[model samples]
Target: MTTAATTETSAITETAALQDRLDFYWSGRAAEYHAHQVSGARAAIDRELWASVFATALDGCGREGSGALDILDVGTGSGYLASLLADAGHRVTGVDHSPGMVSAAQAAHPDLRVLIGDAHAPGILASSLDAVVNRYVLWTLPDPVAAARAWRTLLRPGGTVVAVDATWFPHGVDPAMKVPSADGEDAFVRTYDPATLGALPLGTAASMEDFAEVFLVAGFTDVIVKPLPQVAELDLRFGVAPGHESRPHFVVTARCP
Candidate 1:
């Protein structure tokens, strides 16, 4: 896990700058992204899968929606998950530091609420949310622990926080293939520091343990870890597959104790 270290380049590539870049990146590719929302079928299929995950969490706690469940989607790049929850009757608030991404999300999912804000400081009230969800946004942050702790602060008592992100390390697999050039201005997906992304900074490959510990220390409970495996030829070929190199992605779920 990456520690909350300050970067000098923040002036040039701070969260705000990165957010702007991401916003521009997604806005330009929003159509293509929405088109490929699901591997097969309408974009909503991915939405359904996320809905299932969130519903499972809710169901595990034996709580049905009293009204619309108040949910927050942090780093909600395109607001797909928040839109899904909104469709499922959740009063969803999607936050991303990227305004362009938020705009695109709002444009596509007009019914859902989208906010441009930092996950580290969501501006949402602390201890007032029922659940906070982050999808594929973990690797982008410079400080995963502080970010997670910030999310924890937004949850109400017993509120569940679920984070799903790519947990693959860039092993020297097929290193001969040159990295592809992206079509638009937003080309390279920024990677974390070599240490955090490669081996654990202060620990082993089980570095997620460090991430889990951050939340534990901050006040989350019932932490559950799941590794999603990617095993198809296409998954491997895409290079974005959630395996060990891109297939076996891990997720951590915990409750605000």
Candidate 2:
């Protein structure tokens, strides 16, 4: 085989391996993930903030005499966001790549539907959704721009896409140090190594402008970026470590036009 073919094959193998590792990691921590999200005063505050962000985005989608809005929560580990939206009268479906995570979500919210699927390629019909919401998912994705483009295709005209994330680890931090886990499993988890963590295309390093640009390139309009004040306050009050306190978290919203 040619060198190009060999490189392509290697890349595919690496991608698959990385995905497998992530699947196993999340699967093992499903219960811990849900518990962290729903427990504690800080968790309650974060949920309210997330709900407000998503609720506002969904409301902007407009009913147009239609029934409830159809919302898809990509990477909906444990269905936290899905349940919140469902309770708010929206038709919610959650998709996760990890089978264990999906099972946990289904068990937690039997009323809500959660499926095992890749967030980057959620196999849903085009233009079938009114909104797609994700929280702390971008960092884990290998190709966020591709995922954003896919999300745009999933929404109908005037539909919205909302992503909530933060820069969990800044540039200077030692990757080996105890960093707050985005998966909600632990207050602090040890990293693999500096090289591995540094090589990751983390959303944490991407600024608000970076996210807005991706959405704009993906055919979205009315992009809005804002910080979650409540979340920032809660972080300061309940931060586990020095750098973890009041980390730069923001909510990005864009409309499919």
Candidate 3:
């Protein structure tokens, strides 16, 4: 193979390897992750903020006038966002790369449709969805720009893509800094090498501006980026660990024109 071809092949191999690790990580923590979502006052407040964000994004997609818009929740771990959207009178289909996550989400929301699929390539029909929404998922992607382009293809003309993420570790921090377990249901401490964990493409985004650019380049228009006010306030009032308080979590919304 030529030098350029060799580089491309190496890149593909790395992405696949990283994806496998991610699936294993999430699948192993599926139960604990779901437990953390529903436990404590902070989690409740966060969920409310997510609901408001999704409602606004759906409204932007003209869902208020239209009835029950079809929304795809990519990387719908444990179906937290899917439940909220379905409760708000929208048709939701969730897709996750981890089978364990899919099963957990389905068990949590039996009525909701949840499938095991890659977020980078959701395999949904073109122009079949009014919106694609994900929370804390973008940073985990190996190629978020490519993922954004794939999601754009799934939306209708007026549809929108709403992503909720944060610059969790701007300074290239180690993943071991995270709390061992939030809910205490599963206390599995990650033993991955700090360097390897840090090198993962996830959480490398310096700012929301980088994400906005990705969306714009993917053919989205009228991109909006803003912090979740309630979350920020709660984070201050009931502060988390020392380092986590400063992480700026924000919502990014871009419309397909």
Candidate ranking under lDDT, highest first, comes to 3, 2, 1
**Which regions in candidate 3 have their CA more than 4 angstroms from the true location?**
1-7, 63-65, 175-178, 181-202, 241-246
Model 1 lowest lDDT segment of ten: 195-204
Off by over 4 Å in 1: 1-31, 38-45, 60-67, 172-186, 189-211, 230-245
For candidate 1, lDDT tens digit of each residue in 52-84? 766776554314545566788998877788877
Model 1 Cα RMSD, 1 decimal: 5.8
Best by TM-score: 3
Candidate 3, overall lDDT? 0.78
Say which prediction, candidate 1 or candidate 2, comes out ahead on lDDT.
2
- Best of the candidates, lDDT: 3
Candidate 2 lDDT, 177-198, residue by residue in tens: 4432444433234332344345
lDDT per prediction?
0.63, 0.77, 0.78
Badly placed stretches (over 4 Å) of model 2 are 62-67, 172-192, 195-199, 203-206, 240-245
Which digits, one per residue and each the tens of the lDDT, describe model 3 over residues 1-257? 47998999988898788677667767777887788778876777777777877787667575455678899999999999999999989889999998778989999999999999888899899989999999988877767788899999998887889998887656655544554333232222242344444644555568878777779877889999987666667778877643244577788999988
What lDDT is reached at residue 66 by model 2?
Answer: 47
Which is better, 2 or 3, measured by lDDT? Answer: 3
- Count of steric clashes across candidates, in order: 8, 0, 0
Candidate 3 clash pair list: none
